[model samples]
Target: MSDRDPSVSDEEWAAFVEAARKDGVGSGSVPEPRRRGFRRRPVRHEPEGWRTGPAWREMNGRGRARRQVKGVVGITLAAGLLLLALRPDLITDRLPEGFGGPGETAPLAAETARPTAPPSSEVFPDHPTLKEPFKGSPALGWANGAAGIEVPRAKAVGGMSSEEVAHALDSVKRFLVAANLDKATLRGERPTGAIKLLDPLQKDVRAYIHRSLDEPDENNDPLGLFSRFDPAEVRLAGDVVKARGRMTFEAGERSGEVQVHVDYTFVYPLVKTRPGFDEVARTVVRRQMAFALYDPAKIMTTRGLLYVLRMDESAGNSDCARDGDGFLHPQFSEDLINAAPLPGGPEIDPYDRSKDLADLPKACGTVTRT
Candidate 1:
């Protein structure tokens, strides 16, 4: 099955020998095949295959070492790439942010996406209902003083009975007092200059009077008179006290007025020199609340407290705290008393002789401060 002229020709062998010599074999060269060969070598057994035979075998070790070096280089390159991908900060030398600065906008977490306010009544089956019922004449109505009332919400909502209004006002005051006290304590503040002067005198005078009168000590005192009294209660007037004043509000570039009359009538339960238990228990709250109102610093504290109370008791113009009787009720919202404006008004006055607040409405923000 071999091809014809199986023996390599002498001329071809000579050319192969010359090529091998040029390739730098020192002395020995490929033998030229006989022109008429004694034994014919196969034609497929060409001289081309002879060049690679011994030289390739001899270089096998160097080739193996080169392959190993390439493999190591590849592994090192792959490891470096892996490290760069895994920990980018290592390559880029930048510290992570501790917390966002004022300039930064931090990415919101998943929890922040949840709703903050509770679902409104429209979404729930059973929820507490709020009431707001008020109406007025659009032209020259309560808001415009055609009728003698000057409440902003009330102008639209109409009038409330004296009892409901008083009760609501008292509740708000109690809540405010507690809040003021808490805020003062949390901020590590002490009584101010005015308070220090008045407070010490008040305590000393009351103590002397009680001792002189031979009042039972608080421990033995069946009646809690001294224990229950607020520091602010002072007899500014006679047994029957009366304070009359007026408040002015600027109504859309116009001014409006409301008359205010405050009366305090003290009842002496069994005209005795000593404090009575009934009096201690019954009047403790009233006395403290009265004192809180007396402080000169709290003149315009009324606005926020009153606003909140009104918003809460919005069931009609009538108050949530009204009784059948006409007289105002006095169930104080213990925490909210001090919020009411102090009786004397703001601390500073240019005219030392000025008797009443010249600009309370402005301070309350009910009207513009012209």
Candidate 2:
């Protein structure tokens, strides 16, 4: 009819037409109106604060990773420092040359004195096999047999000719080898070779040796003069014997007499006599003796033969309670375990050759090591 419904007011009709146009209801091509539920909701924007957003989370993650890395580095550093503190030798070994200090060289472990406290159970650590008899002993590095007994270059001293001094030193070395290193002598046999090297006129010395061998007691121990072991009880671990020491000559208390001082330490490796037993024990014997070489013209004494003026000896790892059976009885691990408590005495380092054997306390003492 009149281009609008008669019941509709003009304002209402105008609003309806504007709404239809906005909705594209009367366009050349009509489009369907969108449904209420079909419209997309506007995106909800998060807060702009850096500490509460994704960017903040990324930075925080990186910081946490860095802290973890730092923690690991700190732990490693602490462990390394603790290791260095506990074993300084490791550091010294790795350091470059000249790092120790100017004109300073690190001392070898073998050279340094390792004076340990008296053992509680055994005289020496147990070596269960004969493969390495000298294991855990300073003698491991010592020269074998007569090679260790190096004679000094002979020189005239106290009015003796160089040739005479040389001959005297040779004689002393031969006697030492015979008394200490000879296989037969070590097996409880009489040290005939050693005896022959001595002056025949010294009947007292010969008689004493013979008596000690024949009737050995606590006072007249043959071990004081010879390194003998009972063949029935123990045998030499190997053919090698470790030795180290020096010999020096000076003027004797009388004219035409050259006194040769011999300070030597001999290490003997022994094992049980039983065929199945393989336990190795070491006996350390240090002998300090003075031999007088008298001139035939001036002193009217035997030529080339050495006269025994003094003899002192100290032994390590031997049974302190043993009453001299003419052989050394080295204490083994089992012996220590089953035996009575060892007698108390001063602790001595058997490897310490710096002091004279005579200076050691003349008592049954515990040795620091074998």
Candidate 3:
């Protein structure tokens, strides 16, 4: 039902009718459309730079540059490490043979120096043969000829009777004295007459003796003492005697003729002191027999050129008297009858009998004795 006025005049009715007509024509008021919960979605536009295109491409270019730089740095670091790992000798300087540096050049020929003496070659060929089967023992053998002189006595210091041992010690003392006297003569110093008897009358014999004296003390012991030089047995054959003893090498190996711990002894009356002593001395001088296998031809032809100036004459004299320092003074010392080796040196017996020639493999190295 609609609410309306009950009493209406004609004019009032006409006016209301007129107003209704005007409302119908104009639709002055209409119910608002019911509001809905959902809202209109907004339109999306691309960002300013993206609209230009190639946005991803530009980003990738910068990323690629960074990766390339990283790769280059990595490679550079690896190259540096490689250089550090490889230790290269840098000096271009060339030095003479035996110079102590990587730049110093060693003689190619020297690497193969070996025994060349006929006896050494015949006894010890490049390889062993039946003829050279008997390599001398440190105790005894003829390095060059018939086996060396015999001692006739073969008792150990401990094994010998008290009297025999006493005699042996006395002999050693005498040998030392004789050796000292010989060293004096070699140095142009006054030598006891006893020294002349020890002197090698024959050139070859003297050379052999000198070689023994000149042998370097490969052992680094400051005293310059050999590791071993012990004698065991001496077998006499006429004038020649094969004195056998154990000789210990620096390497501590005991092979064919080398001994670990035994002294070799051979004694004879001094030729100068005793008339007709030449026969006894010759018989007893086992150096010939012992060195027979060594090749004399292999000695170094290259002489040291450096002049040893301001050398301590007394110190040098003492060194020669005991251990020969061949490098500094190749010439044998005249003060003592025996020879001395040089400092920073090589073997006194330069002869090469690499194998059978020396009846043993030649030993040499920065840390070894030849």
Candidate 4:
């Protein structure tokens, strides 16, 4: 039933609602309404006293009360939304307790962004060894310890299929927009939650998409507050070798490590945040999430980017502190810090042997080595 009928489709109307791929964004050219075969309806003039006159007051006081009630209702709705946008805790703090197995606590925001839960002593899963593309393997033609380079630049090898990169970027863009955008962006004051697909067949399908303004993520977390997401590196060779993005927001942040574990169904490189937030510091988390893509029309109805199978986490920040310039830096690896990651982003601890892993609440067995 394609409701392309002229009468219904061409009806002149406006919607004050939200619509888009993620939320709080939408884009697409709506073809101009055709005037043919449609007669213009005359505007109804207001009755006497509607504006300056007092005909309503002379006739009945109930009508005046009704108008006042409507005004209050509209103001109440708008105020609620604004309050939600600014505070956001009405979303992020209500997550279902437990992440690993039964009887686990939340992994964030207790004791001032420092995790307080004890590590689970369950048997650990065997994480697949990380591949060293720059050295170690004969394929790249280099030795691991022979190079005394301060920064080990992992060469981008050929592994990600064209489809994988496309969809992965698709997922990343969706995640970034949702994480950083807000309802204030609805009027175009800021960027909206949306992604532009490159498929030629869908050129006219529209780039902007927004809905679920009040919807929360699977963990019940709100869309993040960062104003932007600038992807610095994206890679996926033989199991998502590396995919890193950076953003600087005012808060206690995190540092992430890399992984290429093969046991999972879909293995994309990930930087995840640790389970805390204390001081205002730049943070990064390796993103290793589990996901599935489908036709936009079908997938849009469900949780969409608000839902994901799994993700990675940074080692905790027990060892992080402010440097001399008042900028956050790793207490152990200050010399190895980078600008994009700030001081709290991922890549601080490679193996996550510190209490950071133990601090993860609602522990996921402490062995979901993404």
Candidate 5:
């Protein structure tokens, strides 16, 4: 059985031959089909059979090449698409530095960021300076005064600045001291600044703190931070902050329309000098956390008051370390090994006033900075 149409007549053959002669044999012309080295391979013929013709031979070669070409094109296109899917950054990063500058760039997917706080020296210069917690109204109500008992400062969705968020986190610097040294906070007495940071979520969250401090677990007291003695002997410095770039807060599981998300990492040292001991005990606490709060009235400056709907705790280490130059070095906690959803990272921020980070982790265990 022949695969050719098999019904071709003498008339069709005559027309094909006429067209080939007219278009071929070089009357100063190259047929489109012959451009790619496509030509008929001569074949033995059987009388009156369609398979024994030049036209058939030419048609077979042309069709085979066309199919192979189509397959190659399809395969190449598919491979290119796969590569692109795996690495969209290859295309995105090549865009101009200002590709989406100023108020035009799209925000990142989540607020998953570490803090970018300025160094400790810059934020709070004098250490061990005691501050009394607000004696009356603030711990109870708006204490913000003219702003009224209702703070209307909650920012719009994604409106809080890194500075603002860092400020909120920094506001707790003294709190750490107070919590560790001052009895006021432990008993639920929050300072004016600390009150603001704890706003919207104030009471319940304060209770949470009290409970944590009261926990009887030894591990919970890590190096006596929660159970230690001596407020007069404690001294510390920190550079807590949020990650640079587009840091944004969105509505959390509890409804963002009525709340704002707050997340950051805090890095600081816990320095304590004992009355009888000559050497001071030193430890660094690197705490990373994600929290959501409710303050739709914008009470906490528009982002609403922080009401800690969700929280995560990272590592903190008391291991004393010395730099290459022999100066003591601080670090995030070792608790990450136990259970820190987000592992701790070194402290970093643009506002560092230190001449150098001692080249930092490199500076650790290395020669002291010259």
Candidate 6:
């Protein structure tokens, strides 16, 4: 009456039934099979909220790994910030205008006598391009072209009428524009416009200008009166030249004459003549000159023409050891890398217009700023 295999022994069948009964087989529940060399441990009922199971343990391990990774990243970021705070100058010089670097401010009027802060030690600290030729310079805020050369209100001076004084001031401004801002004159060409404004009777001054342009030397430097550059070596970074200064008039030392004084600083941004170069170097030229305006009625002189009395100039960022080539050779970053120390007097701040030209040393000197 048994459904057991007929080939099975009676004792073996009895033992199998006992094992299956112990495992809960045929008791209206499924049973786990027993392996030959393994014994099953008794199962205990665990609480519902217990998370000691295999899946929960794996998830906890992954969470711990994520927390460790986050800790490492946070430590790295803190260290970098600490380094930056400790050594700000490491990156401050390289930062472009605005992200905590030096910012450009509006230019003060040429007549304003306010004092300016000392310039940075680096002459060319910022990387420059044609679009931002005046980068890292105070001249960035200056007026372009002839706008900076402002004339004071004309008034009677040295027995001259207001109309005559106004005419004299206008003529002086015109001569300045032609000599320094004219594109043709800047390209190492003769400044005919400036020369024609001179009085024909001032033979000595006229001859000096002609000689300087024709045969420039240490003594007869044309840069004393004009701002010229060699086209083969460098070119203007942009069409605009930054200029700032003032003009005034006073009674002359002699009778029937007025002395028109012109004091101006010109900034010229230059780049290499070759293609594919973006580096910029600036030359600062400050000219202080006196011109005599004679009244035609009292003195036998041309009414419109100006008489050059005295001229003094100072140039910054130029090659102190250059030959008499009649052109401004600005010292670029590359040129200063391996160049010998310039033999000159103490460092002079070219941008400081507060100091008189006579106060400047009479020898070649280094500059504090470009």
Can you write out model 2's per-residue Cα lDDT over 1-370, one digit (the tens) per residue?
Answer: 1222234555764565456446654244332211100001111221122111011211332111100000000000000011111224323333322233121243222212213432121112224248877754556556788887878778877667888889888999999999999999999899999999987655445676787789986545566668888899999897888887777788765556677877778888888998788877777777777777767766545778987765667667666555457677776656744665444545666777776554555545455556
What lDDT tens digits, residue by residue, belong to model 5 across residues 1-370? 1113324444664454456445542333321210000011111111221111111211322111100000000000000011121223332332222122121133223223432543221010111111211111001111121111111233444344444444443333333343333433322233334434554323434553444345422222221122132235443322211121112345433222233322222222233443533222122112222234333433222253444333222222222221111111222222213432221323322122222222223111111000
Residue 159 accuracy (lDDT) in model 1:
30
Looking at model 5, residue 301 earns an lDDT score of 21
lDDT accuracy of residue 122 in candidate 2: 11
| Residue runs of model 1 more than 4 Å from their true location after superposition | 1-158, 183-305, 308-370
Tens digit per residue, CA lDDT, model 1, 1-56: 11123244546534544564466443233222111000001111111211111112
Q: Which stretches of candidate 5 lie over 4 Å from their true place?
A: 1-155, 158-204, 213-234, 237-247, 253-272, 275-281, 293-304, 319-370
TM-score of each: 0.14, 0.67, 0.17, 0.21, 0.29, 0.69
Q: What lDDT would each prediction earn against the true structure?
A: 0.18, 0.59, 0.20, 0.21, 0.25, 0.62
Show where candidate 3 strays beyond 4 Å: 1-160, 180-183, 189-370
| Model 2 pairs in collision | none
Candidate 5: residue 262 Cα off by (Å): 5.1
Pairs clashing in candidate 6? none
Runs with alpha carbons beyond 4 Å of true place in candidate 2:
1-128
Regarding lDDT, does 5 or 6 come out ahead? 6
> Which one wins on lDDT?
6
How many steric overlaps does candidate 1 have? Answer: 12
User: For model 6, how does the per-residue alpha-carbon lDDT over 24-67 read when each residue is reduced to its tens digit?
Assistant: 53344322211111001111222221111111211322111100
TM-score of 6: 0.69
Instruction: Please give the lDDT score at residue 247 for candidate 1.
Output: 17
lDDT minimum window of 10 residues, candidate 6:
69-78
lDDT ranking of the models: 6, 2, 5, 4, 3, 1
Instruction: Give stretches of model 4 more than 4 Å off.
Output: 1-168, 171-191, 194-219, 223-281, 295-307, 311-370
Local lDDT at 20 for model 3:
46
